[model samples]
Target chain A: MTTTSETAQAAPPAASTVPPKAASRAVRSKNRIDPTYYWMVVPVLALFAFFITLPALVGVFFSLTNYAGYGDWKFIGLSNYVNIFKDPAILQSYIFTFIFALTTTVVVNIVALAIALGLNAKIKWRTGIRTVFFIPMVLSALVVSFVFNYLFSNTLPVLAERFGVTPLATSILANENLAWLAIVLVTVWQVAPGATIIYLAGLQSVPAEVYEAADLDGAGSFRQFLSLTLPLILGYLVINVILGFKGFLGTYEIIVGLTGGGPGMATQSVAMRIFSGFTGGDYSYQMANAVIYFLITLLISVIQLRLIQRRGVSL
Target chain B: MTASTFSKPVNKMAPLGLKNRSGRTRKSGREGYKVNWWLTALMLVASLTVLLPLYFTVAMALKSPDQIGTGTGLAWPNPMNWDNFAAAYVATNFPVAFMSTAFVTVFSVLGSLACSSLVAYAIARNWNRRFFRGSFVYLLSAMFIPFPVIILPLIKQTALLGLDNPGGVVFLHVLGGISFNTLLYIAFVRSIPVELEESARLDGATTWQVFRKIIFPLLAPMNATVGIFAFLGSWNDFLLPQMMIADPALQTLPVVQMLFQGEFNTNYSLAFASYLMAMAPTLVVYILAQRWVLSGVMRGAVK
Candidate 1:
């Protein structure tokens, strides 16, 4: 609000105040509606409304009915929602998705921060190593998952057998108990680079002078990292966690490629459930589930926004 | 400045001059300040984690069926096979899928840049208006709606509108990106000095001209950031294309790859070859623009 007033003061005088036949015909008011700006925004807004907003609303509307994604339907009025809460498969997906999201978020942050610290250190070929580390981020997730799928199903077992490692001799993707770990490993492998870059940015933003001053105080590196580095980069940590958690919540493609949410739904995510339901003649039922999922995500987003705003973070 | 200037010579000479009474040179480097050999070694080992899988992809692609079955997966194939690539290429109709993917990636990047920047410019400049502010929030709200929630409805809608094709994917990509990209762009557009636009306005430039001639050029850095995200997101996307594009012939690379996985599954060499080919363009672009891509991702994170 203050910024608005400040910018308004910063702009030129309003166009309406000036006469029509003024010598200088610059008729502009930064505070007022500019038709050209309206033109620029309206089309985008319209497209967004038509594509995103409309579909979302339509999805919600259908959630109240028993529409099977086609043909005639009747309003079921919360029946699907009630069934969703009671369904074991749906419940299982929720449990798996949350646990997966949490585990991956924690694992990724730890690995990423460590890598970022290592990259930040005065190491040889630092830039080269950093470049190598980020390679996974640029590659497609599904392709990477396929490559890993082959590794997990074939190569790993073969290697494990020859190495005399009994526990890992069988393909982990076939093991319901252990398959989620494979997903987590691949996810951490792929997503850690992105998080590392963020942590690196956070680390780099802390002036070297602070570390040097800590050195003068004879503080150990561990102590300096604990008391100085962590506190300063806390903002980046929050950003990484919020963004990473939100993203991991919607895990889809990697699951599809790696395990197909298989070993009897052991690795199924809420997204996989919703998608399968859509095609498997559970349209309205899934829409109800989706609505609930949307609410949860929306709640998280709202909380994230409030946290960011309170911290005076730009995003 | 004074502390650094005074400390420089001492810092340089300490390693040479400092010696323990026991006649062995102590570790003069600060434990945290200097490189830890163990950390470097550990990181090197970690780097192998990235390199090894990529190595396997290449190795598996070139191996004969007999060789692949006989050896440890780490072994590289002798007289590496080029036939797999040709076979995979023909099987996947590589050029069409590649072109379809390329088409989506290019337009999505372009559309995201144009629309998000325009919206940001409008909302940013008119910050005092409730409508503009509300529009910003409205777009941001779209971010929270998980794509799966709306995808089923979107499929039905697109089919009815005769948009269940690659073009529809492009439209959705652009529409989907507006939220975060506008968030990125609006922050950037606000940072741009109002004086530039004001001067342009006084020069009888219309609002459109002011934006085009001044604001847009200044937005190059953010454009790069947004463009990189848009490219990667659309290029690597699987779900939208798989569901949205009704025609098999018009599907994107990721979806097409998934569709043909069954056909290639019996042949390890062929599957790896197809995956490698599908991965080639992104790898090439990343290698060529490594610096920009890395920095762009970092910049995006700050937002």
Candidate 2:
């Protein structure tokens, strides 16, 4: 690094016969360290270490013990971990959380991509339509869930009854078997617009010349889209899927607002379970569950970073 | 490949009419002006579907008690009863909740901006240094650590330190938001020319002065983005404040609204009215800053 800077400085004055070593030293001194930069970063780093890193480490320690969130007793290594696997509620939450995340990721991606494609076209009222779609992206998830709860409970059923639809006569949120679907519907509604914006950006970046070239070869629109557009936006798809999946795994407020984990805990996410544990005085067991959850997210994040790096996704 | 290459030169001088035809087709294709009315109509329906819940909330909020339980509540309220809002305002203690929410949002936005930008500036300016680079990576990794992973111990730690109030929640919000905000600021800071700060430094301005006078002013756009994001996150947040602030008087708007909903579950008008009240601030802000919010989502996604 030092040598490159030296050569760069020396290249501008090739006629001068100055010593390379001396010139490099001069440039290095010109780039002298500012102690204030170190000072400026201290508070941020301190807060990060104390508030984030320390608590995380403490959490890991507590996961192995019988810490009731307040007065602690002796450590019981792996007991909480063992109990987590045996607990039906935690296991059920894990299953529901994964199901919710996977289903939402797939559905949101397809719908978002479709919306992006439509919005990208030269249609009338494009900006107005885009804004309408994107409005939910800015609203609070909790608020949106509550609003939807009313619709599912009151409005939709009333409409269903008027239309003579037998199945929808009852509120969906009150049904154990179907309540998770309502949560998924709301999640998709709230999240698809944000994904649509990302996909729209990706769509905009696809070169028009590629499609034009394909047209000259007599390739139809579907073939052109398949052969040209999807490949170019594959990176964006990976990003949306990973980020959306990880985010949905942390779902809490929406569940609280909609069904409050449902008629029988059928829709409880891992986060809901963890919070309940805190309130229920099952602190260490929930700490163990949280640690496992942390590791799963960490693994997925690592995989995502690696995939982006390998694909060289600039966006 | 050889045949196509040789034929391309010969076909390059094809009829002018044919060329124009192809050119027109290409232009039309590029602009996508061949309107698909079906798709346009479909998108309109989808937008309406997405807006239905919001429409229902507002409609329900505007209805009276008699109008709500009836099927006609789906339609607009005839008399347009405004009493529900008043009842909701009283029941939820809207003034106290609104104040608490505003305090958390404003302070969190301000604190996150100040700390994250300073650290970001340090890292961006000292890009070649090992420590700063390490700091950047360390901060970025914090993004992977979900809040639930540490909430149990965090509650204990905060309680032990006697910081379990709205103030504690604000501090946590500022800290929790620093990683992403710092990342955004670092990207913006890198684009700012160092010569401005260097020249100021050479003129004997302290490093703090250089940052305060030059660098900070240059980061106004990023400050807006981060501030809006921090505001949204803090305002919408329920879990941290719900867990941290035990006192009913100190609860944020979302938590208060949730509790309020539980108390007045049977009063659909008052319930929906309070819901609208809770959501109004964000909706207003979103409408005012829709352009920035949209662009910011795209930009943040790119990172």
Candidate 3:
């Protein structure tokens, strides 16, 4: 709020004078209302309201029912949710989702930040190099999953045999613990590049003067980056954290494509569980799982936004 | 000044500097720091590590079914197999899927943009001190809603409205895109001086014409940014298309690719090959638009 006020206060007055007097007056009168604006949003808002927001409302209502596609919709007050906790598969999904989100977030940031620093430094064909690194990000997550599926099932096991740990899964997503590791690893490969690009942009935007000053004080690259570069883009880092976490929560295609969420209940994330229920024509039950997942995601995001906004405020 | 004087010389004498201008510094030689030899090497390895998988995908795309399994992890095929490319397309029913995906992406992105620009223009033009805060809060609140739950209800709603038509599902894609689209465009529109629209107004142009003639052209770059995201999201999207389109004929490319992989069962070569084929649209779009992303869209994006 204060930041917005500060920005507003700092803004220069609209000073254009070349326009006709009537034009300037109308423009001045319309600066805030821009009446045409709201109408344009109607179609989009209609879509968002119908598809994104409306369905969410339906999901909430459906959670309390026993609608299984074709059956009579009997309202079963919270029974679906109560059952969600008792089911070990659902519980395993909760645990797996948390662990997957945690591992992917940490690993992705480290790799992305390192890549960002490298790209920020002098390397050949910087744009070309950034694009090359970004290739994984551009490919369909499903395609990436298939690529990794081949890598894990066909190529990876061979290497494991020669330079092996207890061959985790014959297929990466099939083994419980190894499925978790493979999902994390594959996710890191696909996601890091985009995060790295954002970080690189943040890195590039750090003023040259600060680094020059650091050098003048005899600070080495590592110290200078720590003291100067990191602090300036702390907001961006936080943004990436939120993005990476949010991204992990919705990680469906990869999990489905890679492990199909299991040899049993190994890699089935919250989304996967919800999907499983829906595919079985158990809409009401799936809606409950989805609602719980949504609320949890909303809660985490709220906390994240508050934390980041607070840090951004202070910085 | 003194540091740059030092900065240039420190880079020249590293063992790998080709000219090896060892005498303090050569006139035009770039500065050398303690032979960043390790970073260069690490970067080389990192570059390969990232590229290797993609190279492998392309390799598998060309390899035959027998070769895909028997093939060494990284080995080049001796009798390079390219027939897999033709075979993947046929097996996947890719041409039909491709058209469906294109149609869906185009309509959805356009829908999202029209919706986004309207809302943004309205707010940017008419913001009152009191109302501005309320609208921003509402819009920002919309951003807080995570996306997974949107899928389940979408399944219900699509059934309710007979949105099972491939065309009908585009709205679902557009709906999901609106939150970001509005937020981004509103920020961009705020930066545009309103006087241009006012001038058009004074010339007796309607608000629609003003937007069409003036603001829309100016907003083109930002639109491209939003379009890129919308296009890619729509093109590569799996779930909504998976759920909404029941008929195999109506299925989008990504969904078809998924079905193709499973239906093939043990024939992993064709699956990976078709998968690569599916990715080509986004890959091409990203490569073409990648430059505009950082240089054009991002210029306005960063506040």
Candidate 4:
């Protein structure tokens, strides 16, 4: 996945043109170690090893123990992992997270792709409209979720009452069966703009000549899009889907701000479950959940890398 | 290839019929380029819908408690109650929270840039070496690991090391950001020509000197992109600071504001005002740097 040689071939020509040749020359002349380059990299590697790698390894180890967050512990030896399968709350949160992620990924991609196509067109106020759509992407998730929380709890209910719309009178976040939809809605709202930007890049990269050829072939707009645009941007679509899905798996702040996993834990995500463990004294148990989450993300990332590498090579 | 091919016809045809249909001619054949007024209106309406939350927050922030309860909250506040901002400012300990947030963002951005760029520089420059190649791969693979996966032990580790403060969060932010920022910098570094570094090396500059004088300066645009990204990630972060910094005094803007919301749950105007305050810095930064932010995000995605 991290093949430098492949990247050199795939990278755009302007910046990488001289570096590969220069690097090879350096390599041929010096078979020995380059202390300077090694020195330059040590700080970064040290930070990565200590903060990221070591803690990850420690986390795996902790999952086997009966340790609270602070105090000493006994070796539990997969009991927490065993309990994870049986614990209804943990299992329910997993199901909710998966459902939320899958739903949001589908909705966000479709909305973002449509908006990207629109933004890519030669429309009036294109930049202004694009900025407006992307504004939510910049705001903190907690803040956006809070604003929407108010909208759902206060503004929507008030407007609903005024219009005599009985169904809309209740805050959606408080509805046990339907609260997940509110979380999904806010997730898509915040995430779509970033996806739109990617799709816009993909849209821009489509050759004009290909579109012209489709036009001459008498393809309608829908046919042109299906036959030309989608295939061309399939790579970007895969990237967005995998990244979006993985990101939504860690849905924390949005859920916290909007629903607080409320109305009988109907909207709880795995992340919420894990963090809530810190205060609840189930630290090691949650570490096991975290390890599982890690593995799931890692699996998705491997698939993403494979897809990207294939596409990268082809491009 | 596409740009040159597409531009040639437009350039040649400019003299014949350029003035009247310059806009139309630029994208003459594409259906999306046509002047579809209805589609334009639809898009505008959609933009308004997307902006509604932001608009509603501002409106609610300006309303008084009585007006809000009276169900005129969506309407503009009569005489626009600005006192909500003052009240929220005091309630949320806005100054301390704002300072903490600023401190984290500044240090996180700087630390990420410094560390990631150095790592990226070494990898990009030494692309042929086995060690650097392996290091690059190692760093890039870390992108796959989510924060929650490590947060359990990271919290414990921070406590043991006595780094579980705002400063500790800064350390985590910088280190956590290394993977993505390194990826971005590596892409950008690949684009930079090695000629400048080569000349600097030829003039007796050490590797450090070459990077500092030539490579680092050329990475200014990428520095901005990575800086903005790091800034956004650190400033808006909730879970890390919320978990690591237990002391209310050391909490950042988002976490503090979340607490403020809980405390002021029924104080609708004050809560909305604090929400606006929490989001104001990022929104202002976005407005000022939308072009860079948009382009950087797009570019980052493609990578």
Candidate 5:
């Protein structure tokens, strides 16, 4: 090592005395490891481990026991996991969560994309209108739900009754089959602003020259949009869909505010199921359910990262 | 990307459109297109989806119980019972809940800014180190663990540690945000030239001193981005405070509001009034800092 360092210092004229790679390696090794870097990183890492990582691991461990969130436990092996598959309530939650997420993702993207296109157009009061559109993005989701709940429950039924619309005369929140639709309406109302902002950003990134060129080629606006705008903003669409889906899968506050997961558990998301199980004496069972939910989310996140990387998107 | 990326297109394209408008009048060719009023009208109607609910909230909050029973729930109240706000404020114990929420949000924002940026600076500067690279990956992996998966155990752990309160919620909020906030900061930090830090290092500044003096000041835009996210997240959070906070009085606004909601006996006027109060701060901030908040949210979404 000493000889390598000395030779590295000797000069380029005597480069053949020692292999250049070895000298460079020795010099590189001499680069100081700052202890302050450790000081900067370790505390945050330890906190994260203690708060997030340790609990996750502990939760997974408990999924294999009959701990009841407290008391003595027996190693139950994969019984909880097996029971989860057979359990009607758990199965219903997974189904409802996936369906809700899928529907909401599709609806949000379509509405947001259309609104983004309008905002992107040459319009009057563009900034003001954009500001108005994003109001829901900043409000608490629970509050928004409660507000909409009153609208759906009281105002809508009165109007429907006056108009002689039989199907909607009563509150939809009381209907087991239609309550999820109400949740979807409120969720879309609150969530569309966020997806719209993302869509607007993506739309703004596309160069105006692309549209100008299309116009010169005798393409109409619709043709240009389908051919040029859609392809360019597809990355944002994919992102909004995946991120929105992942987010909506953890739908708790909105459901609680709207239906309290009632009308016979019709709107209970996987998150609600897990949370309710905590107080419902189904702790280890729900932990198992939670572990499964975690795996699904992990898989989706992995896929999202891969897609983003492949598309060369920074986020 | 910076906040300016959001408005750059509008600034650039508006002048182009104006220039095209002048040329189009003279030539009458396909140099420009007119503003589509149909789309504007459609969007205006859609905007009611946002406006009507808010209008309903305000109208409901101000209506007397008698007026609420008489109308289709759309008319503005003439007498305008302003007493609901006063009543709901006292019933929800608005001051305590608001302060608790403010405490959690403020600390969460401050802690996230301090801890995540420090971690990012260390990792970004020492990118060649294996341990630093490993740490970044470890932090990034936490994003995949859904909060529900760990929430139950977290409640148990925090209770055991005597943290079943708003303080614990603040701690988790900061810790939970580190992964994404660090991701955002690392990307931004990599863009900052090392020469800036090298000068400070040559001045014999320790790592902490260099970070505090030089890098933190330069991270203002990212600090805005991360701080906005942390504030909004901690402020609006329901699940954490609902399940984690043991004392009813110590709970944050969202959880307190949830508890205040009892069936069959709920006064609609008071409930709506309470929601409006809880929503007021977010609305005020958004109105005051519209540009920065909107652009900050946009910047956060893609990166």
Candidate 6:
């Protein structure tokens, strides 16, 4: 090693050696590692590992055993995995989870994109309108769902009754097909504002020069949107998809408040399934379900992030 | 819907018909005039679907339970039963829950900023290190690793550490958020030029003095935005409390809200009343911070 270093130092006359020297210097510096950031993370990493990483590991371990929330944990190994495929309700929950995610994802994006475009138009009284629209996002999902329960499911029906039309209450949530749609509608309403806010931020970052060029080229609104706006904001579009997916996996409050995953367990998503299991005193089993669901969400999110990053348009 | 002293042709060309002056123009050749009017109107109605329900909520929350639950009381809660809010306070464990929430929110915010920023400063200002970089990426990816995978271990760890209490819960939340918090702060620290630090160094300020006296103050803007967001996030969080906080004395508002789901049947009006009560802080905070908050999100997007 000493001879190698001595030769490297002594024989480095080539032009390319300059670049290699810098690269090696970087490697060496990286090896030594600064303590500043590391020290700062002492408290954070302690908490992160304790609360986030450790619990995750415990959850995975719990999934492999029958803890019953107490008593000796029997190491059943792959039995939990087997029961996942075997149990119809468990498999059905996955299907419903996917549908819930897909539907809410589409609806939130379309509505948010439109609102973002409107906001981008810079209409009069927009701040007021935007404030009005964005207000729902501030409410916890439980709170939002309760308000909607009265307005759409109860009060709107009363108004409709006055006109002699059948009430439009979401008693249909007790039905299998419509229950999904009901939750979807409420979910879209609650989250659409958040998506709009993100998109609006993205839209604002588009340079005025790009738009000016589009206008000068005789590009109309649609043309400009197609060529300039869409291409430029692909990053935001992908982000919205990921956000929608997270929202789907994480959604428990609204589903719990609105339907309790009822109508024969139709609307019970993976999150809901875990929650229900927890409430029902089947803690270990549900944690296993959550672990499976988590893996699926992680795989999908990583794939999506990778794909978008690969295709991302660098500014 | 009222003609509004504007015309379609005008707004189409000029993007008019809004309630403000986005630019110095009255009307030009209607810019987006000929585009689909139905789509915009549909969007408007859809947007109103969000507003109208909220309107109804405010309307009913003003009424007595008798008025709200019975008869046609949707027209501004006849004579405005403002006592509904007072009743809501008692019915929902409002005071105690608020205290719990406030206490939790305070610690979560302070802890997150402190832990996240310290780590962030280290990562951003410190010299290049592969170990740190690798770990940073690992940490960021872990956020997407599904809560179920980590949540169980976290519970075990928290339990081991006696963090299952309310304060402990806040501690867990702060730690849970460290990765994202660090990401935000590290970015902020990197954006600060090195010249400031070099100048401080020339003046012989200790590293802590430089950070406290200069770096921390400079980071105030980004800190405000991130802090407020983290505060709001912790305050509104429902899932953790639902699973964790078992003691009624320690229950947050969202936890109390869940109690209305009684076995027999729920009192819908009382539940709705409680829901509105729970939403007050979030609504108030956003309203107060919106001017800065909106711009903050814009700034964050590029970073």
Best by TM-score: 5
Q: Write model 6 residue lDDT over A1-315, tens digit each, in one string.
A: 233334435655564735553333323232344244465656566666656776677777888887777667788887777787788988898888887888889889998888878855635455565666777777787767766655555665667677777635335555677778878888888888777866765675566677777677888889989898888788888888886887687677788777788878887778777766544666678877887787788788779868777987442
In candidate 4, list every pair of residues with a backbone clash.
Answer: A15-B191
Report the candidate with higher lDDT, 3 versus 5.
5
Report the C-alpha displacement of residue A222, candidate 1, in angstroms. Answer: 1.4
Q: Residues B211-247, candidate 5, lDDT per residue (tens digit)?
A: 9999998888789889999989999998888888899
Which residue pairs does candidate 5 place in steric collision?
none
lDDT of 1 by residue, A52-106 (tens): 9998999999999999877899998999999999999999999999999999999
Lowest lDDT sum, 10 consecutive residues, model 6 chain B, at: B1-10
Q: Point out the worst 10-residue segment of candidate 5 chain A by lDDT.
A: A21-30
Models sorted by DockQ, best on top: 4, 5, 1, 2, 3, 6
Model 4, runs deviating above 4 Å:
A1-29, A309-315, B1-26, B29-34, B70-72
Candidate 1, residues B90-173, lDDT tens digits: the string is 888888998999899999999999999999999998888888899998999888888988988898899999999888999999
Better of 1 and 5 by DockQ: 5
- Which sections of candidate 2 miss by over 4 Å? A1-32, B1-36, B70-72
Model 1: colliding residue pairs? none
For lDDT, candidate 3 versus 6, the one ahead is 3
TM-score of 6: 0.85
Q: For all candidates in order, state the fraction of native interface contacts they contain.
A: 0.64, 0.60, 0.46, 0.63, 0.63, 0.42
TM-score of chain B of each: 0.87, 0.85, 0.81, 0.87, 0.90, 0.80
Candidate 6: where are CA atoms >4 Å away?
A1-37, A163-170, A277-281, B1-47, B69-73, B263-269
lDDT of 5 by residue, A267-313 (tens): 88999999876788889999999999999998998898898888886
Interface RMSD of each: 6.6, 7.0, 6.9, 5.7, 5.3, 6.9
Q: What TM-score does chain A reach in every model? A: 0.90, 0.89, 0.84, 0.88, 0.89, 0.83
Q: Give me the overall lDDT of model 3.
A: 0.71
Candidate 2 displacement at residue A309 in angstroms: 2.7
Off by over 4 Å in 5: A1-30, A309-315, B1-34
Model 2 chain B: worst 10 consecutive residues (lDDT sum): B12-21
Docking class for model 3 is: acceptable
